[model samples]
Target: MGLLAAFTHTLEITLPVFLMVFLGLGLKRLGWIDAHFITTASMLVFKVTMPALLFLSIIQADLGRALQPDLIGYFIGYTAISFFLAWAWAIWRHPRVERGIFTQGAFRANNGIVGLALAAGQYGDYGLSVGGVLAGAVIVIYNVFSVFILSLYSDEVDTDFRSLIKNLARNPLILSVVFAIPVALSGIELSGWVMTSGGYLAGMSLPLGLICIGGTLSVTAFKRSSTIALDASLWKLVWVPLFGVLGALAAGIQGPALGIIFLYLGCPGAAASFVMAKAFKSNDKLAANIIVITTFASMFTLSFGLFVLKWLDLV
Candidate 1:
């Protein structure tokens, strides 16, 4: 496609995803939904709907063809490097209380929700298949690092490795990917009703997650954390993707693998960052502010990134 056509296509996919966020914001403002509903919905999407989406994506994929070893290696390596770099930067620059929050915001992405939606939007099932694998891998790294870093900076100095392992084992997304891989490898064709039901659940994941994201955004936190929020937003949305895509290209990554990496890199700081911050007694407000700003900023960055990628025929 021409640049103009690619740009249009990019917008076509992204605008609706963002529109749901705005719709969610509007609904919350109009009192159609409140904090309780948003929290509940977010949990439901995270625990149930997103797992269904991942399961469907993986179970239906031809993993022998779709799962690229190089791509997986690159994703895991890039995430590990990014996590340590962000953590090192935080330790070097920030005060004790804010270090974990800043580090988490810098490297953690809302991949399962925002990243998957954008991938599916641009490339349909192929995108979801590739993106789901990447998400499953990256989320494991994300959770492990998040717990470690938060624990490092937390007032409670003792880190529970066992609990972390249990949480990782029990993670719905991780479980979905694990369970689906065996079935996918076995070439067992699910019943039509099973496929239909999975599709239905998968379809609900993105829209519901987007709305919850919108609903949870807090305008009040902006003023208090504007500087840090903007800084984190730039790191999350701009620098991360810029360096990531460049490094991936340098390493000869291309096609859907490259596209999935770009999508994950450009995704906003996850809302789960705030949850982690709160749980660890780090700077929760700062984490929330970073999420809010990065999310709003990503609508532009992600669309532009996709347009550029499309123009270059990289995705």
Candidate 2:
């Protein structure tokens, strides 16, 4: 596609996704939805709806094609490298209490929400299937690193290895992936009613997740921590995605796999980072600020990245 066409195509996919976010913000500001609603919706999306989406996507995908080792390996490697590098930088630049938050904000992507939405919007079910698998794999790695790093820096005595394992085992996304992959590989068809129910829940995941993201964004927190917020946002929204996509392309990742990787890299710092930070006694305010800033900034970066990818005929 030509540059102009690519831009239009990219906007066609991204604009509606962002409009939902803005609508969510406007609704929250207008008092139609409040903090309680945001929290409950977030929990619902995370625990129920997102897992349902992943289950449906994975179960419906051709595992032999969708489960690409190269793609999964690249994401895992890139994420590990990024996590350590960000941690090193965080330690060098920030105080101990804030290091975990900085590192988490810098490295974690909102892959399940923003990344999945972008992938599904641009490429539909095929894109979502590929992206769903990638999201499942990457999120497992992210949660592991998040728990380890947060516990490492945590002042709390209760943060233990058992808790880490427990948290990972209890992650709904992880569970969905684990359960669905075997069934997918086995070629077992879900019962009609089960598929119908799952599809219904899956349909609600993205919109609800995005709105929760918007509703949770705090303008006051952004103002309070503008410097750190901007720094983390730049790392998350611009630097990580740019380098990651270039590396993925260089490594021969192409087509929908490449698009999903690009979207994953370009996704904002997840809202869950804030929750994890608070749970582990990191700088939750800074984490929240990073989430807010990166979530907004990614609208531009992700669209531009998609435009470039399409212009090059990469996806």
Q: What TM-score, over all chains together, does every model reach?
A: 0.96, 0.95
Most TM-score-accurate candidate: 1
Q: What TM-score would candidate 2 get against the native?
A: 0.95
Query: Scored by Cα lDDT, where does model 1 land?
Result: 0.87
Q: For this target, which candidate reaches the highest lDDT against the unseen true structure?
A: 1
Cα distance off (Å), candidate 1, residue 228: 2.4
- What is candidate 1's lDDT per residue for 146-187, written digit by digit as tens? 888889888865688899899999999999988998989999
The alpha-carbon lDDT assigned to residue 51 of candidate 2 equals 95
Residues 146-221 of candidate 2 have per-residue lDDT tens digits of 8888888888835566877787789898899899989988888879999998899999999998888888877777
> Which window of 10 residues has the lowest lDDT sum in candidate 2?
156-165
Candidate 1: segments with Cα more than 4 A from true spot: none
Residue 85 in candidate 1, Cα distance off native in Å: 1.6
